[model samples]
Target: MTHTPLLKPVWLSMTLLLVWLLSACQRETDLVEPTTNTTVSNTAENETINKWILENMRDYYYWNDKIPASPDLTLAPSDFFDSLLYTYSATAAPDGDRFSWIEENADDLSASLSGESTTTGLEFMLYLRSQGSTDVIAQVLYVLPNSPAARAGFKRGDIISKVNGQPITTTNYASLLYSGATNYSFGLAEVQNSALVDTDKTLSVTATVFQANPVFLDSIYTAGTKTVGYLVYNQFVPAPNNSSGTEYDDQVDAIFSNFKARGVNELILDLRYNPGGYTSSSANLASLIGKNISTSSVYFREEWNSTLTPYIKQEYGDEFFVQRFLNKSQNIGGNLQRVFVLTTDGTASSSELIINGLRPYMTVTTIGTTTYGKNVGSITIVDDSGKIKWGMQPIVFKSFNSQGQSDYSAGFAPSIEVQEPLVLKPLGDITEPLLNEALYQITGNRLARRAVATGHSLPALGSSIQRKAGGGRMIKSLTAFKTAKLPQ
Candidate 1:
């Protein structure tokens, strides 16, 4: 007997459901009732000494995915804390290169992963950069091509050996990577490994440091007859911890209200590579484009009760609630007419939830290649054995349009496909001619054949054509809700 995958034929609704507890919060749950030792006062709070694993480790088994055999773990709670969370150990083990220094009260304090976190690249620094730091970026993960770093020829594993002639080492990532003068001219070396490389093994490059927060509305798109509402949404950092973040409750209000005020009809949501920040952030965005928009249903959620028998997950579901960041009045298609999004493979997690959720209500169109097909979300576990593991699982809960379309694996099929063009003359500079294509189609204005960029297949100027869309995954429709779309 074979199996299948579950997908949501994306309607641009928010698919994110709040679940996993942050490492600190999880530690609070696992703590033991303190003893009555007279030495320590009652008010003295227990200290949790554990390396914070940024991602969830244990997860559900999709039929298709190979289920790793569960390991036997037996250790006292305190010992479990030390062994599992490397940061909690007397001496932390090196994670790749340098992990951040862990402190008990440092939930609000964190740095970029030695290399960029795969799920969160530079976008993670929006807050860190705002607060200001004197650290160097020793390594970066490549989430998108033609990005500031990728266009600069920065690959996933490239290590930073020097910044502006200053040598970078593991112990000093914060100094060389984070600390820098704004718009300061700096030369950097890309090393194959952390080992100080000779000139031959490294590539020298330069970058300007700006505050991490990306400003939206920098440019209003009123390119004649194009009824477009342009909103710049990048990255999803949870509230409070990240300074670059606007309050999850009020951010969406401003974005949509501005679009309505601008007399804009169509929407252009730029999420080129928004590594998911907060599930709350995603829910807020989804409420904007959602059609009927139910408030009291499972959006998406998870559970882990390894302590009890079954020793696994007790249950999971997708639950929904009204997000704080919403307009008091329902404005489905008044000032706002339709949606057009810019996406890339680097667009993942909450980004996927947003695109996947808003599918039905708006005439949503995506301009880019395929999205990062991450139907599954993650949950982390620091077991009693002192072994830290990130547990990942796709939630059983989902959202569907009035038409009952929930195709998780297939993702959102773009009405139009556009590719970013890279050129050599400028070296790392990129031009988004695809944006022009999307703008043209939405405005009812056909471009001249010569006006269209050459290469790749899509509806060209003067060509009325039907094309093949890239997204086709196994989605979980409402009827087949109970384990029908389970991954095989």
Candidate 2:
């Protein structure tokens, strides 16, 4: 009918439509016939990345010999990398070889190693109203300075009853709190008459990127003639971008300096909530506490995989095997005979390192529940080429303290077993159960106990809450290496 009409406007439109169809066909053809050079380049680049990963794993992985001889390289990088891990048998222990992991972004991993992250600036412990109860309650454990939670006027011991206007239950608690939300609405609660009661007050907080200072709380407590330095040392991370320098060292020095000035004799390191950090920072903190220990003394030793052990021994010598205590100017040199370490399941890695490393030099009395058992450490490995952003945090070595003790795979049992109570108190508060026990151990004075709701144990909290927060302390080595220039 259109052809019969033969209108000038219709004829022109038909011609234009034909031309447009031809152009679209040509474009599709061009896309299908990609250049050989580009195809070859992509394949070559992927091969290069795969090769780099394999080589690094062979060199640095704790179980280098256990890696598959011929990995399926055609698989995705993350999958291929995981396939090489030492597979655990059904009969073997659960945590046989689960520490090694890979990160897509190396820069972010590096930043995290230095204790920098986007956070709400809040660290809280989730607890059931009672054992076996689905009704969950969160007690603010500590707040990082300059964090959104702190800005929102959140203080430790503030109970969180509801999240996003919904009552916090075991089912939705993890998703509500740690789902990486940019904003959060927290409904406050308080324990009245030994029961959790909802309050009218609510606070909204937005997460922001901030550098967390590892030194959470520090105070010099005086009980009679005993001057005790109590430090809530959260992590072993050094100051941001100043890991090589004394930026973090200076902070520790300042605290100890104040302690020294005040003639603080006894030391109580509270690693109750500390998940580990930099190994070097751990060594530094240990050196400051055990100032009388010789700088030449081996604080800790690293045991690499059998493949690289011989080469490392040859290149770096025996001294390289062990990390020695540094004789820094800031070392307080208090020469305390015994030190009390406040611990929980959260106390792990470098926190445990400080405890284990200092044991040969001093009496480390561990209080609270068992310490997180991680004697192994990891090194950050990044792609040599700027093309790939992938990073690998492979377990490189098993660390042994001065006495060659790395046997804490099942966690270090507390000398004085005490569980964190359901009713919480502010950090450094003598009335807090953990701190109270520590002080009682120190001064032999039983401070009046704060009334707590009975039937709360760490195992219940560990099961309900810790499982949601990605359970246990993930300790990363302060050490970093490039893919191209890995140590022998």
Candidate 3:
């Protein structure tokens, strides 16, 4: 892996990864100066780590002003990190922080943010076996191609009732599914006649370190005089294999290049499983779809805390806060009037940003369900000294579109609502529920519906156990801010 100088701290929305290189002479305090004194009790249990946490939180957290002046220093690092957040509660604090988190291993967190993790590549959702029962069933959403799960014949819509011969319940599912085991034997089941029928069939798979490519699928469908481009983009990663290059972003460009070359007019961006990643990639995507835009056209803007905001303004001027569209040769927005987005509860952060950012330029019609409401972002802080093993992802900024619209905290509701049915179809199949709807909207002719055996579909519990990272995030390089010399 190529390590940059500013790898110690990365600014992110919800799921963001950026490695920046800052000047060797620049001090960490140049951008964020710790408020608390350094003489706090270091001998207390976890005080040393907690003190470091407090200092960073005080400097960079979006709700920095709301944090208590003197917090409990004796709490564990994770607990202490939680105590400082202006937590979002449904009734108590509806507008508080909900995405900031701390992980024990910074390396693991970094790897996960970069789309690298150990897994069976089983993306799934959890559903209650019955309306009132605690028993849970795991439905395979979409297995990563060539993954262990795919090699084991786990396809979309496959159901898992048990793991290691033990029934999956609401209480034990997390530990049973994510037990860090090297291998697993899944007990299979099927939804027959609206009832879950357990079968004696079992399939076992092993977990291995895998790096997923965010560009899942892309194709073109021609109907009469209209041509549509369909892309299933699962994440916004700019690269693969922890490289500093923009390989993934370049692949997206190439996909659009093909779309534009093929005379495609209509577009369907599938972001149902995209949690969010690199903001730079998001801009790259939006630029390709935003009609009549240029490199100077404002794409989105960032709003940091009071301290860093004014400092950035003073150092780099107002333009520093704005991100502009990149001039790409493969832009297809010029040939399109509207774009359809496929979404779900899992769609978040940079995913939402794309929708919000493009609406001002074109017709952005969303399908499927409401998004995973997350408009704010965080900064990934790892101890450069290597003494503190924990990594802190603190919400450091809120994002807004070019028109200054940032009020989608409850998530953007779909214009045309459709849910993924209990019986799933393989993605990229034009007959799939979401894609079918998009094609119908474009061609004005709906495909013949397949009759179902029963009207009952699995109740969506919104619970899932998947090997993915970062939902609702945008990442920016701190090097942009560090390059501007700060006053001593």
Candidate 4:
């Protein structure tokens, strides 16, 4: 029998009852009702939900011991969840939780993990019109292929200055764009002499359930006698639907197969916009690029809490937490000694995993800005008993490369730092700033000095996907916990 690669469907078959080391606290059945006025609709139900949250956090949270001894159980479910977190505060607790999140609907959370979501497909960056200005402009990043934004002709670098015919400002952009609305109209603008000049143009789009294909674009480039393979991998999803199917992973494998067939000697793995997904796909990508690697080669190691560490060992054996390279037939790492990874602040979790995991095996040169720096990984926790509808994606482990290094919380600074220009170029284009720098570094080609006009460019406030749910996340499959049972 062939070993099936673990995917989302198999991971969702997890049993929720895991034996956890609980702190000394009041039992869930002994909880008292709060006298204070609260926002929760059903106090009893919310308490039940909070009980579930507390139990899981105590069992799996990286900072499990840091959870409060007596959290407010009467608070709203989301608030109660927050109260249990050792939340990261720059001055107070810098190393605290930064990525643990709870979603009301586990289905949405699961869909997000697989790159499916109800979205306008208009991924963008919000920038202050000018320094110290409240006026904001939304610059389009790459839109999903067949979604509303793409259908409305939204391409990368298009600027939106108004929403619903009103000029967008810091105070109203969120309300205008993300107000649980399905339809939206955007008014266009152009950067003229350091100012946004509104145009007589409008684009209307309707948000829908869009399954973004992680493989955005792939091409083979010939730069200075070197056959180069450039892949714009936006996420680490194996498939669009989160099924057992490996559609997206197959696409990556096929791309690598083409690269191998064409004798591509150099590789430019563009992950500048990648925010991470499944570790399975990350391992797949690494297997395609890692030099002299095999199923026995260590890709990364997981460090869990003491309770889980020993439990996993006893339940699943020693090699259970260790991830290894897949034995991919189309691997091209043998033809190349170094790989160029283009990155940005959005490059995170599994993206960083690929970079860190490959460094021990080959020369991994990164171009563009610093990475998002998420070395920790998470797991999707859903109550299989059907009583709890909420899903918890809590930090479960910290991952280290084979050298036992996992210190990238502040992010990885690029080997060749190239800040992409405000005026974005089409991805996979040779003239693009980040890719150009990578080519220059590889072939000794002169780097282009493209200057952003002094007052025209503003620092990006944020992007649509930068802080997206599950961004910089590496999820462990539920199959690893199949044999789990609550302590008697």
Candidate 5:
């Protein structure tokens, strides 16, 4: 079955529901009692919002039939919303609904979707020096450009031993690292005599509103006769304000354009720390890398619920269900046959979508660890009233590649499996283990390996650590609407 478009029939479904609810309210006049205008207005508004939520769920939710037919409308919106999730069975193990969430402010939610957030702009990995030990050390992953952390001279591979003069332990790391503090003092350290020794150097950083640019790092490398292009894309966010003409996407296009001019024959896409974003951006990236693929060929497919399936089929036709590769002037449709993808647990959603979507057209070799398996996408819904800005992001559809494969909930395994090295190496450095592995595969020549200094080795951090630090596979959502609207 073909999948639905990211541009869903949300307004159409919402309008039909509102019309039905207005008719029902007229018929059930007895239920609403005569009261003060203020009280009556509040009650009516709540009823309208509740009715709209239910109707949208019925029409667009992936498990629409599982929603109860007679849920209490007077309950708090959050509680009422939870009661509608598909919980499977009481005896079954809990696979919590981690995706669906309601935002109190639609504007804030919209900003977050556009990759704007307040932070010190630091992405790091935490590791325990010994198994089950409290001595936890953090290795800097990558710092966002123009961020507070970046201004403080923090870079990839910097070891952080202490925060605010307190040593980092498993018990207190959460409070010290992720307690949403505005200002923090970090102590630099190095391995000395088999122990983490503070170098007496301290740097303080203040968290501020930082616009996270998804295109973190992009460069072209010369490996003998092969010109390799490497891009460290952190998210799949499109241009801000939902503007057309590829404002954000043009950043990528410009990079590929340089690669095309440079006669680049190989591509290395680094999504190691990406947690997914807009689906349209993913499709665009796939198109740029898939040089030989035809624009008319299907990139991915979507599946919707049964009740609205035929209606969508009749309304938008078969083409609406399948996203095809876009033909663009900047696309690097070069002499390449295979692409290399660098992934970790943080690689998810549209990241996985790009990996899966490109497989049918080219040879994709994934390095590093397995991916975060998320074959589903969501749409954001807000109430009709401009007063209440509450927005709902619910998983509405599951996506599949052209080959009809979407069973990768467990994640995609790496073709060349290698864990990120505990001994820090600067990103984009040829000596970096993951990048070195990719170069080895591309050039058929092994690069010289550097010996790790004794006492620098640390225990492998569990996936749970990544999850606790908000570094694993993420819930990907689609916000493709040209403008916010109410169901008229």
Candidate 6:
């Protein structure tokens, strides 16, 4: 009993220790039994954040108010949003719980649809430049070669007035041209006779749309003593339907076969503004001209964050090149060599693919200014809602060249960069200086002689289309090389 009696100092110390122990025990108890409502609120907060993200994407393009976009999105939608213009920006989500819907399928939704938007007009149409001459039109793209329109004798510079049973008025022309008539084939319409009885008169006529062989023909030039061939490939896009009617690929194959047969000393394939088409077609052309070819382990491919919501990877393929490409893989090939390409800012997509594919094997000499750098692409898919969603905000996966360098964004620089020559041509005539330069390199009586004297053959280009000792008369057009300027 006496020992149990504690001093006042000891009692105080013991009391403090007990109080500290009690406080520690209380902390543990609280930790073991979290309030159910508190946990639920936390989960709700996370869901709210995700909801905010989805809302943001859905409402990014609303006019009056910023449509509330969803917030639970991964990094892709945001990146996609920044890349598009106001006219093309899109944010779509399901009517209910938009967050979960997008979270589950946003990646694909952003990429699959084509023509997300048009800035200046409602649809896509070719814009032409008037090259000053009353007879020549400028800024016109060659949609088909030897087609009814071209063969019906519609020259490159001919101004089209109307299509089948319609006046080529501005109100309907854009839409009409984009929605061209298969009936016209390759033909173009012009303003018919101005009769007092008929106020607006335009008539549709058949043009030449025929089976033309791809031949360099004897259009080669010889300056001092060299032989040079000049050929034009206006477009490379395949037809929607045809054995070879509108397919750029068949044209390419024909061109290569002609090239192989023609025993060319030197050649010029005029692609000046050949707005690129066909992925495999371009590759085929490159391989034909290329000496060493290597297949890519990966092409332009992209990978999205898998953990965030419902993320999916983008697979860029021959088809997706028209869309923005995502991730791509390549296979090694048997050949590798040099390639000579003439290009411009108009050279895009599948056109660039040719350059990229040929870089590893051939001595790539780009003869134009910097190309349009649109590396990323997307895919289109109809979701469970049956709504056509351009899902898979496809990203640039891999631009692995044979050399193991991916400078796709920079585009291939011209070894001999030249620009459009300031020539005195009418509105529709193009100013092609690069093509002439390539000709200058291969042709010229003096050049042919020099090559021969230098112990090189005058390009016994394999076929019978080789130029004779002296070539044809020089054509007086502004396809000159010396007059062009180079871009910085």
> Over the stretch 247-278, how does candidate 4's per-residue lDDT look in tens digits?
99999999999999999999999988887778
Name the candidate that leads on lDDT. 4
Q: TM-score per candidate, in order?
A: 0.48, 0.82, 0.89, 0.90, 0.81, 0.44
C-alpha RMSD of each candidate structure in angstroms: 14.9, 15.8, 7.0, 6.8, 8.9, 24.2
Per-residue CA lDDT of model 1 for 1-488, tens digit only, reads 01124322111111232111112112221224334552333222221122122111122212112212332123332432333332323345221111111212221112110011211122211011112333333333222333355444555434444555665333553344444332222333333342224353444333432223322332346646554665556454333322434554365566666666676666677765453434555656666655444564333333212221122222222222112223334333455556777765545556666665565555567877666444433221122233222211123223333344445443455556665432101211113454566566665544212125533221211100000000111111122222313222
Clashes of 6: 102
lDDT of each: 0.36, 0.67, 0.76, 0.77, 0.67, 0.31
Query: Would you list the clashing residue pairs of candidate 3?
Result: 12-378, 13-377, 13-474, 14-473, 15-473, 348-472, 349-472
Candidate 1 vs candidate 6: the lDDT winner is 1
Q: lDDT value for candidate 2?
A: 0.67
Best TM-score goes to which candidate? Answer: 4
Give the Å error, residue 147, model 5.
0.5
Candidates 1 and 3, the one with greater lDDT: 3
Q: In candidate 6, residue 232 scores what lDDT?
A: 59
lDDT (Cα, tens digit) per residue for candidate 2, span 386-462: 56676666667788888889888667899988887666678898878877777887787833353232325522343
Which ranges in model 3 have alpha carbons more than 4 Å from their true place? Answer: 1-45, 446-457, 463-467, 483-488
- The TM-score of predicted model 6 comes to 0.44
Query: Which portions of model 5 miss their true places by more than 4 Å?
Result: 1-52, 72-76, 87-97, 169-172, 193-195, 241-245, 446-488
Query: Please, what are the lDDT tens digits per residue for candidate 6 over residues 414-480?
Result: 6667654312122122223565455444443233321111111111101000010000000011111
Candidate numbers sorted by lDDT from highest down: 4, 3, 5, 2, 1, 6
31, model 1: CA deviation in Å?
25
Off by over 4 Å in 4: 1-41, 446-457, 485-488
Q: Which run of 10 residues does model 5 get worst, by summed lDDT?
A: 13-22
Candidate 5's residue-wise lDDT over 387-408, tens digit each?
5556666667778899999877
